[model samples]
Target: MTERIRHDGIVVVGAGLAGLTAALAAAPARVLVLTEAPLNAGCSSAWAQGGMAAALSPDDAPELHAADTVAAGAGLVNAAMARLLAEEGPAAVRALADLGAPFDRTESGAFAQSLEAAHGKARVARVKGDQAGRAIMEAVSVAVLAAPHVQVRTGAKLTGLLQEESGRIRGVLALIDGRPVEITARAVVLATGGVGGLYAITTTPAELKGEGLGLAALAGARIADPEFVQFHPTAIDIARDPAPLATEALRGEGAVLVNADGERFMDRYHPAGELAPRDVVARAIHAEREAGRGAFLDAREAAGKHFPDEFPTVFAACLSGGVDPRKQPIPVTPACHYHMGGIATDADGATSLPGLFAAGECASTGVHGANRLASNSLLEAAVFGARAGRAAATQNDAKGPFTAVTAAELPPVALQALREAMSRDAGVIRDAAGLTRLLDLIDALEAAHGRSAPLVAARLVAACALARRESRGGHFRADFPGRAEPVRTVVTLPALERPGLRFAAE
Candidate 1:
């Protein structure tokens, strides 16, 4: 028999930055936070190296930040959403600092900022160089643990969404201590990070296989931009699962990309060289690796002796991989870094389904249109997370008969197969043939393992990627090499029932 519990408050799934932020903001109203792993583990927020992006510098303005965000999104960005994120970003960063994030400060006591890929101005507020995510999450975790109205429950893995017959989500079905536990609440907030684990090589926690997104889709929630996924160009090329990252700050500080022969290669790819948009740089590195020249990030001249103090995280990762950044050019590769698409939501994190909300990388709020601006992810998480929390606090429990929606679990072997297929086909560069093969694999896996969450998420990415025939942003197609009309792909499971059916383009 399954255990059932009722909580007269909001249920927040995930324990990352967004989840904790939402929990903190939903104060006075009781909040039950659930996580598959212990706090600060199995979360991408803690692994993030790049700091949050905001217009905190005197020379920078919110307008400029918004403009850069739109430019990086490559024509599909929602202008209003970008502007809203930019306008609210500064305060969000300052708020985290107030919570004891310990952001690097200038001699005059102002927040020190760094220049990343597409930003025209230096505006990324960091912590001890590349320790932004860890430090910020530490501070937020402390606050959430101390908050009176918040109750955190670890070792609870979300398995399904409990929704009313009217499609109103009322709670979640989770697996706790190897038993099925149903927890019903007034509102459910999904901040379950990204789909990086669906790929073989990623810069995110391997446990983040997009179960939240898949369960949401199965529960009839709308999904947006399912084809756009960002691949960071400089994930350290050690043979590590969920690859370690070499933050873009190194490039900002004058690092360069080079081939195996010690030849600089970025100049041949883009005018910005080491600082090109993520998509461009990823493609460049991919092309180099495919050509057998090999790709590397030459940061010897950039940090050199200051490597230990400036980038301790990266320095440790390199050392573990038997490569010293001070003496050797770090081998690099493109890996799944962030998902630019997910359960579609509005500016306030409210999804189409009533009583349900999403934030963080798992929710596509249109701030990141096709490709995300560098370092903007953390900012979006903090900004929209609080918004979602505040909004969910006002929701009252629905009184109606509801059905529990659950999915089968994909076996480890099948999941590994799926991950390999995703990395090979729907990865940095995609085309029709590869995408079709990927879909076929997903179909086979589903036929054998039932409609598992990972398979559903993988199908969403492949099907939508196959439907969209243009090369733009992170989704580059070799067959359709040029950009066509700019349109956002919006989908639901019902609409994807028919093969070759193009999703509703917004």
Candidate 2:
């Protein structure tokens, strides 16, 4: 059934940290926020365990943070943007603290920080060791609910963008439960998280399968770096699909990665050993598993007595899976965790299409170039989410109304096939043959499903992976073992329709 819409000052989709932060930033100006699931249930933000990183400690500085970010990004981060976010990261953490996030503190009542892999300092500010995501999301959720100007609509899924005759985004078409509704807003922000749900063995919620990227693409926005998907090395592999994550913070606190033979294996992979960057760790874990060495995180030496308080999430997940963290090594396997590429955005979170901004994992903010640093995802959400909100709130317009088109749904079997194809072909490892087969499979799926929103996103990732021939970050290619000349893969839907599916170099 068709329901007409009401306009708001801003519309923010996906009520994770980014969407809620945007809503809070736009406050006093009426805002509407939508979430596909209950606020705490589906978002990757709540699933995050490692904590937010900021140069808050006495020994650390923003410059150090920027340098680490640049190092992790592999020379692709925008210098100005990285500097701005890193310099301001402490304040962002403070703002969240002011909003009542219960961060762990030192004995002196100062903010406590932990060291994560790839960082040179103890800059990660966590909550109860591993409850950072849950605690922070809960705090923000309370703030959003209490905000007088922010109205949150739960169980509302954004299906597509509504545009003006001039091609500016007007608002969104959403499905609330089974009923379809169109809501017009002066501005729309997409914060629908990452593309991990597209894979078979992922840590992200099954429902969040790059729908925002798909919707944005179908609405004609430019996409960037669609090939790079980060796999976390320590997803507990107890015969579970969409495995549980054992946060890297455990190792940061001194846990070691070992093979079945009780050998410390990370030393052979990188100089950083247990503290290498995530991509390196994930690749190491993948290689170990592929070689039948059997890998696990042995946190017992460090976290035996502190498991419950330090890492409630990991402790409980392990308990449920019949592995006791205090006595046993948690079985681990690499699983898709984050996507470095997404709806392309400028530093201010503005997409190619005006009036639509994206933050969090849904937008490729370029802060995370080839891969994301351990806890930087949450930082990017708050900093850029606020930026996007402030930028969008200042720009308001009155547009004429028009009829809205409805969103299409994919069949059950087709959806399963798409997931299986992504998990098998476009997963952690890539090769020319696999990626090419993935593209062709996507083509066949689209021929049947008419390039439905999800399939469009899947195809974009595969096509981009097929084009980028070199192994870098989360995208490792056996065919192209070395890093070739680094160039960002940028694609526009119109450009893809050209012969050979080639994107013109800018």
Candidate 3:
């Protein structure tokens, strides 16, 4: 039997920086926050090592930040949205600091910032080096727990979205303690993170398989740019399931990329060497590894003894793999990091559906068009998260007859197979043959296991990637190695259903 409940306010799915921020920002309006794991456990926000990007220095301005963001996105970034994110980013970081985020501070009481890959200035505000994500999440978790109008229900996994015949999302149907519970509310917000878990090698939590995105699409919402997935160039290759990241800040601090022959190779790929954009660096490392040279991040000269205190997270990970960063080069590989596409949303986080709002990695606000700039993930989550929260709080409760669309679950073995396939075919470098094979595999899996969320998300990535024939940003095709006219991929379930549908530029 399914249990039903009615909430007279907004329901937020996901408990990461975005969802919690939304819950916090929706002041005086009752907000119910649901998550599959305990606060800060399974979400990528807590695992973020590079911290948030914002223009905090006197010489830097939001205009510069926006320009850099647009340049890094590889021609598909929404300029207006990038401008908004940059203009509001400083305030968002400051707000988190006020909530006791404990950002690293300079002696002059200003934010201690660091330089990252594509940014023109040193503006990434970090904490205790690689502890930025954990520290900031700890502070946000504390604040959310203390908020009067926020109710957090952990161990609740979202299975379906409740929508009316008119396509209005009412709430979510989640599984709590192995029982199905339908919680209908005035509005529904999806901030369920990204689809990294779909890949065999990923830096995100294993539980994040894009259920929110699949459910939204199944319930008929517009998805944008589902093909642009950023692969981080330096995930520590220590045979871990969810690979530990060697943050880009290490390169900004003068770390170099070397091969097994101890030859610095990034200079051959790009002029900026280790400071090149993520896609270029990732491809260089991939090529090196493919050539049997085996890429490595030689940070020994950069951090050395300061590694323990400066990047405790990376230090511990290296130690776990029997490698010391102070004396040795860390083995690195490109791993699934961030998704630059998701449920299409406006600046305020409102999706095409009337009552469905999205924020964080799950929402594509045209900020991260193709490849995400280093450290901007956290900033987008904070800035747009608050916007979605406040905007959702303004909606008045609506009553309507709706149907609950529940997704099928993929078994463990099948999911592992799917993951391996994704990493092989649709990963850092993709081509028509690989993508077509991947889609065929998805079809077989869907035929066997029904249309699971992970399968849907994987299909979306593969199909769109196969359709997009040009090499641009994070998406590269060996067969078609040139850029086509810059166009955004706007898709809905109905549009995707049409046979031979090519994504037209919006």
lDDT (10s digit) by residue, model 1, range 164-185: 9889998999988789999899
**lDDT per residue, candidate 3, 18-87, as tens digits?**
9999999999999999998999999999999999999999999999999999999999999999999999
Give RMSD (Å) of candidate 3 vs. truth.
Answer: 0.8
Candidates in order, TM-scores: namely: 0.99, 0.97, 0.99
Question: Rank order by lDDT, top first?
Answer: 1, 3, 2
Model 1 deviation from the true structure expressed as Cα RMSD, one decimal place: 0.8
Over 1-506, each residue of candidate 2 has an lDDT whose tens digit, in order, gives 76867776989999989889999998678899999799888998998899999999888999999989988987566667788889989999999999889999999988999999899999999999988898999999999899999988887988778886656888889888768888888889999999887888899887878888988887788999888899998999887766889998999989999999988899999999989989899889888988999899999988998899889889999999999989989899989899989999987789998889999999998888887888999999999999888887876765775444333566778878878788778887888788778778777877776767777788888877877778888888888888877677788766665668655323
Instruction: Report lDDT (Cα) of residue 444, candidate 1.
Output: 91
Error of 2 at 90 (Å): 0.5
| lDDT score for candidate 2 against the true structure | 0.86
Q: List the residue pairs that clash in candidate 1.
A: none
Task: Candidate 1: list runs displaced more than 4 Å.
Answer: none
Please give the distance, in angstroms, between residue 467's alpha carbon in candidate 2 and its true position after superposition: 0.6
Q: Which ten residues in a row have the lowest lDDT in candidate 2?
A: 401-410
Question: What shift in Å separates residue 334 of candidate 1 from its native position after superposition?
Answer: 0.1
| lDDT on C-alpha atoms for all candidate structures | 0.94, 0.86, 0.94
